[model samples]
Target: MVKQQQGAGHSAEASALGFYYQAFFALLTLMRQDTDNAAVGIEQLDDVDLKVDGHNLLYQLKHSTSDAPPVISLKSKALWKTVKVWVDILPDLTLSETTLHLVTVAKLGLDSPLIALTNLEAERTELVEAMVEEAQRVLDARAAASKMGKALPHADRVDGCSAFLSLTDTERLNLMRRTVIQPGSAAVGAIEDNVAGHLKLLPPEQRPAVAMRLVEWWDRQIIYSLCGKRERVIARGELQHQISAIVSDIEHDKLVPDFEIASPPRDYQPDGMLARQIQLVDGKTSDFSKAIREEWKAREQRSKWLNGSPAMAVTINDYDLVLEEHWSDRHSQMVEECAELDQKGKCQSGLEIMRWTHENAPSTVRPIAQGWGAAYYIRGSYQVLAIDLKVGWHSDYAKLLGDAE
Candidate 1:
């Protein structure tokens, strides 16, 4: 067993590789394309990485029990290196739809699978083989349909995540117009027009020979959608975990440039596309942007709460319990310090003031050193009560964080 504590050690990038690998199979299957079945084996995580439709992907797969974190910071810092590498690959090839993505997937180990087959190896040495065969079948079906002039619609890429062009001519052209496919973009033409050329400019030495290797890979491998038919439930769960982690980071002041959660996440519609798009998103970027914003707000609020209150308190008036808090230690300390300055004769200056909260906290909260103690804030013709003070002896940060009732 590993250290099972909050903010535990990192996991490996390989955890996500399975999902990305699945995605590759999905892509191949979707394309109605065919290729060789064997891994070219230039090396794993060395001389070669996986490229699909010209996009380079780093797939990190981890088991549930795995205890390594993927190289998120390393990849972010080394982006320029990858860019230079991409520059080396595009010159002699067509990389019109290329992009780079770093993916990490956490998966269940092979001891349990939905379909249990005896003699199936625990190492899953045959799983990839089976997946490839299934992918080919899916591709063949697609090919047969396409030949009959019946093709399925492709999904649009989620922005800030990945970009994908549709198999249909109209959508593909529109996507092409909206994006530049080359490495020389931003330096040359407009952002949209230049992306394509930017990709095409990759150095010839790194380019895959389109006539054989690219086609062969396409034939041999297949990609399945990142989302399965059961994706809605999985998406909700994954999204929640993702959102919660981000919220925690913001609360800790760890997320830079700030994180905010917009009211909704995406502009979804009932039976429209994403059922909750509008309710879940706001502004230009929608869910991706909106979610982070709202989460930031909640983090800020929590920081504010934690600052003003303590885990517990001893109080008069029957020792009333101030159950939940929403402030941070630093901010609350500053608030108390300002109050102390006010109590003493250390008068006026802008530094003497923080953001003006209500002149009074609720009555249940009596001021103590924790700073989160409550009092009454004036309401029109009345006073409003807050949750800042504790009258009783019970305290739980879990409840404070909303995990407990």
Candidate 2:
């Protein structure tokens, strides 16, 4: 019993890997073909492994973990199970338009009965007759076991074989005619190679980076669809747009900003020098919260940028210097305008300076890269400087924070 449980656990893990392969295979299909209206769905429409709407194709993906997987022959359970699924849904499909596909990593033997299904020119009448004979043999064996008061271990396979026998001769021939077997399909690790192959138009050195970005984005999109966060159908146009965006970023030397909509933790409280500087000028609670959120996003994005090429590090340093200069100029202007004002009036003027900086500073500063327009990155960078005492909002921030001039 313990051994059986371990085997079941291993099977479940392999099944999960199979689902991932299915998603990758779908992505590969989208990349290889040019069909504007085609959309792909996972685990929908009679619970087929994959359903490509617009193309009228349903796919069953069988993945194995072994380096030397067994052959998919006439009596292979995976083949019959896939056939059984299609047979059950045959009533709802248009025989002339719909195609059923069984995609597996297992190799097909020279004498495999399903070989005829792979070839459009092959005569399928003989194949249909042979399937009927095999189905009868399976049913007879189950009958023999029942007469001996014993249960067959694979009752599901027996049921699937029986289901095939119930179809009429015309239905059987039409079903066999539309079925396709794609043996030796790409495994989990090799799917990456297949994806890169479809990107031959790209420069050889850029293919890997582009493939990685596309695959990562595809995985996230699949997860979102599965989790009900978005529509389940993945349109080909959506994938193409993402590819274009990624390529554009790489070519233009731009950083794609992440965490743009991210928020601080619910229990987070504004603290430290940045918050103190805001408070010194009578900044409101909303101002403090926005400042903290923007600072967090900028710091996170900057850290990620620094992890890249040395050129990116230099870009960030230069951008920070630009922000500091902007703050310095603004601070000097605020001091001059409020020179004759009393303490309360000076504080009011300082608040106005902060408001203007937040509203207009992003537009004045030079972006780190061409076509990159994440204003939060600019706003957050200024807050980051204030946190480190390199810049601040109020005119007397240095003295208020007890910093050396």
Candidate 3:
């Protein structure tokens, strides 16, 4: 039982690794495409594949973990299954323009009949004939086995071979001419290196980091498209634009404000330290809600920055100190001007301070990153400070909260 469970666990791990390989290969394909308008889709039109520049380019990716590469023989299930998919969809494709690719980490032996398919100069008619002959042989063997009352497994492979032989000579020739067998393709790790190589616009030290970020973004985009959360295709131009933006941010030493649309949980309540600080200024329920959201965004962005790099962490700390000093100066001035006023008047002054902080503080205090102009970041950072009791909107907030020390 334990052995069985261990085998299952190993199988599951290999399956997941294969999926990651497919996704990374898709990223490599998108990076290598010549046309900017070409779009890529995963598990859509093909496995780890899609259309490029109005021409269908379907790919079947096969990943292997063996020390010695597997051979893709004529009767290989991977080869036949790939052919089956193309045959089933042949009617919907423009045979003249559509290209089918069987990309695998496996190797094709020198004497394998499928090796001819990889040669563009190979005679299409001869290749088609060879494939048809192989398909017929498989069917004939299956028939002989059935006559002996013996059942052969892999019905899917048999069905695929039969379907290939059922096509007309001309159709088979066309499909053979369009098909390409790319065996011994790069493994998962090599493919990642290839992806990083394409990021020549980025510095050598930054290429891996940028490539990782690009692939992560691509994975999310693929998931969103697959889940119907967005369009089903990701254009090459979109990918190029993303790369350019990431490079620009790195070059300019600017941080990307990635949490603009981030929010707190749906059931989030305004009852924290930040909320109480707002309430001390007689803030409304709406103000409390907005403050909570701003604080959440700020904290999330800060966490991301801290995880990004030591430089980013230092930048955040410096920015926070600047904010604290700015708020202290403003708070001192507000307290002096409203010191002679009644308690009700002081409350009104506190409300005015809160309004100014929200409306004008961002403009006065520049963002830590030069290119980032998101005003909400500044407002949210103030809320974060308020939450930590470092800053507050009310003139006597420290005394009111019993934290004057």
Candidate 4:
């Protein structure tokens, strides 16, 4: 009994490994079937596991940790059912291009009765008769004993068995010709590695985002499988759109960044290259030094004006506008303009920036606002690497000048 139990465990493990190989094959199939101009998606399903270009490809992947038995033949219950289904669906002219494949990690079953046939077309009638005979033999032995009822539905048993027996010689030949038998197991890991290489072949700028999108796509595939949703194929383009939509939704609902200000202000330094150039080109008492001093003094005066009132902090109501202004214009000019406004008390609150942002903010610019914080500041020198709105504004504007209240 213990020996028998051990054998069963080994069998179960092999079965799991085979299932894993099948899934990997499906993923690799999707990668192969994906095209830039067309959309396609893959789902775990029946004999036809992949659907593309309006043609269905039935992928029958079989794998084993060790070599399978010698002479593995296509004479099993699986083969018969596949044959029956294709026969029943033969009348559907739209599905004429559907192809059947028998992929296995094991050698062909040489001893199986179907192995002797040399010419499938010439011996088509004989082949059908033999297949029907084999099917009935299994049904008589297994179905009557109720041992394989779950696998062989009682309702479709007569219909399917009859269909296979009735298929003409030409029909049998067609089915036989369409069938593809790959008897050797493929390198599973190589499949994924090849896919990774393909992804890397994409444009360098797009590779990173596309890689992330593939991850999201894989995750969604797992979730869908877990939910028992079977065999739903989609265009790759459509899948990409779905993944992007998911990312957008996640950003909108869950990725809202927080803004907080510290009282003493954060320690920072000016752009090192600019400072070094200034030190090397202009002495401390030179005109450059005087200009630097004036810029510092202006920044100091503006900071005081903004942070002056113990009762209030300067606020920019139009963060988007302020962000846009800083991005589109020179930082020094923006600082000068803001300083002039502060002198007039118009810059007491960020209401102007906020108002401007509200009026001009486009959907394209909304993603940049995700990183804004209470510590936002502008510097004439390279004190802080600010977001340049001219290009893709990858940086966020710190909104530190005022309290949220």
Candidate 5:
């Protein structure tokens, strides 16, 4: 075995990085249906050890010689510096359009008070699980939000978002009773309010359509994301994050961010993209993050029914999605990649993403929508990525349901 050297615990650090590489590979396999983007290629960017799709991931594997676990920090400041420096330089080496990220894998997984691979206590596993879930929460939400606004005539956007957000908070204590979401409860409340306010403002003409679009998007795009949210909860085991202002539409056509009254401190730096990603990681956690997404969709659905035609309003909140600030890194990555393949340059929008997910994803991913064809959508997370989606009703009701379902 390689011994620990004086150079920033390179041995242990590299081992942790290796584990991240494996996990990420598995995640990509699940993410990429055709295995193209999933074919990650690593290159030495000035010998600093840059991963192909290894940004904003979190994780720490552990092994003990005799007693318990390791500490959070792996080694010396130089080691931490190595990571920080790589993060700073990665942007320069990344694909001009793709967002580069810094994935800091913690080697503090084993022998600690909580969380373990084998005989670890449930509390420990849950604690570590909490951290992992928080990060995933960020990734999922970010992906959705990055594709909002420019949505087509989806029917479920508002309702799904509304219900999911509401349910998330209502059950936070239960989901994270063994973790730290309590301290951030106030933040959860703020997010719910923010989502509610924005969803309420969806174009009065298109509420139900958007709500349904939210649910459909989730089924297709996120159902088997980079890291499936199945039973296991492990970090990138890393967290995908981004910083976003919970802006509101006032008298003017301005999207004014509302951080002064939220849990996240308004002083967060937003100049650089990386800084924003980190900020989002802290803001949109899983405990409340997933719930918020579902709520936004639901809200859109409700809006459609309340304001528009009653029965004809057409509820589709079952498929819409909101941007998770925390997981914005992966979220942004996927959206942009899909946007590029959208084939229709500059046509990226809510409708576009919805159309793509519905048309491309397996039948299980299809969402409920009204009208005859696909929909167009804009960024639901950040202000950049957008895409398309297929829509309408099928003639063969029984066969279509069986096949689709």
Candidate 6:
């Protein structure tokens, strides 16, 4: 039993270290995306995994080597600790910009329904219930242990207990929502792949040498500190400094001037079709610009339909009419279906209409609609009829698409 526990401990430690390495690269990739002067660190005294500019993001990364997926429960010790950390930081000014994110390489535990929660109201209720339960559990356990002269499993029980009790319902909900879950191995894979792009973004002339240097520098300075081999504690700020130093040296010795870096030319529009289409429709770019400015001025009046009944359903046919006029596939089955639906007066009504659209609409439209979180189709004919049939439909469609809620 003792040997097995020790082996398990080693495995967990190794898994955590692997996640940190990936997370470090992920943070680095995000940091290099812009010219913003920011600081990022790991295992900082602030209980934050990454801090950039004024915003702090805390990530609790989890992975399982077993066939079964790793699970994180709201009632778990790990979650309570995370909550405690946020509570401790709440009074600090960074609290406004700080966010707590949970990144895991597996699905959440079955007991945690918070994963499926989407409605803001429902999420708030659940978070409040969970927070209250966890606070009671921890405080009770700590009190019992103290009375028995026994040591509890968690440290900082005194401060954590106080902070947990002190947090209001609104504060708890805000913190809970900020605790985003990045599920599955896909999240880690995305980070690793994106880091490759960041590496490619390095000056083309010194790319290979600079890439090799970064790898060596990270291995020498960062990896040891992360894995707990180094005796003295190294804050993330120190790690950031070391990285900047290495990159600076490489640039000074082997790279060209910052001004010489190739950049996309101004007004270097990529879409020839859009440019020509706008010119043909509005007669000039100035008219196109004026149209956009006028639309911004009357956005509220134009979006009145969105404020109507949530039950009001917008069918694929309605979306097609609004969106497919300029579509390329004029004679496709999708175009035929749109024509058929328009003749049948098939505004959003039931599953049959949904099934028809799902089956017949172009492969592209259905997914885009589904991404807008349309579980069932609603009749949006009223909205379609009210809007300017020629040009305003496009703006209305854009507005509806933006209203993901």
Query: What TM-scores do the predictions have?
Result: 0.20, 0.68, 0.68, 0.41, 0.17, 0.41
What does the lDDT read for residue 60 in candidate 6? 50
- List candidate 5 stretches off by more than 4 Å: 1-35, 46-69, 73-79, 84-88, 94-405
Residues forming the 10-long window of minimal summed lDDT in candidate 5: 180-189
Candidate 3 residue lDDT tens string, 265-343: 8986643777678777788887777777877788888887777775677788889999898888888999999999987
**What does candidate 5's lDDT look like per residue over 46-133, in tens digits?**
2112223433222121222212223432222212333333334433543332322222222333443322222212344344344344
Model 1 TM-score, 2 decimals: 0.20
Off by over 4 Å in 2: 1-16, 34-39, 46-55, 223-238, 259-310, 320-367, 373-405
Best by lDDT: 3
Of the candidates numbered 2 and 5, which has the greater lDDT value? 2
Q: Which stretches of candidate 4 lie over 4 Å from their true place?
A: 1-20, 34-48, 67-71, 84-93, 109-163, 166-170, 187-190, 197-216, 225-231, 238-405
Q: CA lDDT of 41 in candidate 3?
A: 77
**83-145 per-residue lDDT for model 4 (tens digits):** 565676566534466666656555556555454333323334455567667656655655765
Global CA lDDT of candidate 2, please?
A: 0.76
What C-alpha lDDT does candidate 3 achieve relative to the native structure? 0.77
Look at candidate 3 and give me any clashing residue pairs: none
Per-candidate Cα lDDT values, in order, are 0.27, 0.76, 0.77, 0.44, 0.29, 0.44
lDDT of 2 by residue, 1-405 (tens): 001111223676766776678778878866765657777767665333333444477777777777767788777777677678878888788878777777878888998677898876678999999889888888898888989999864565676787899999998888889888888887888888778778877898777778877887888888888899999978889988888888888887778776576676777654487778788888999888788888888888888777655567878888888888887887898888888888787788888767665778878887777777888898888788777788776677778787632
Q: Is candidate 1 or candidate 3 better by lDDT?
A: 3
List the candidate 1 regions with Cα displacement exceeding 4 Å.
1-121, 153-357, 360-382, 385-405
TM-score (C-alpha, index-matched) for candidate 6: 0.41
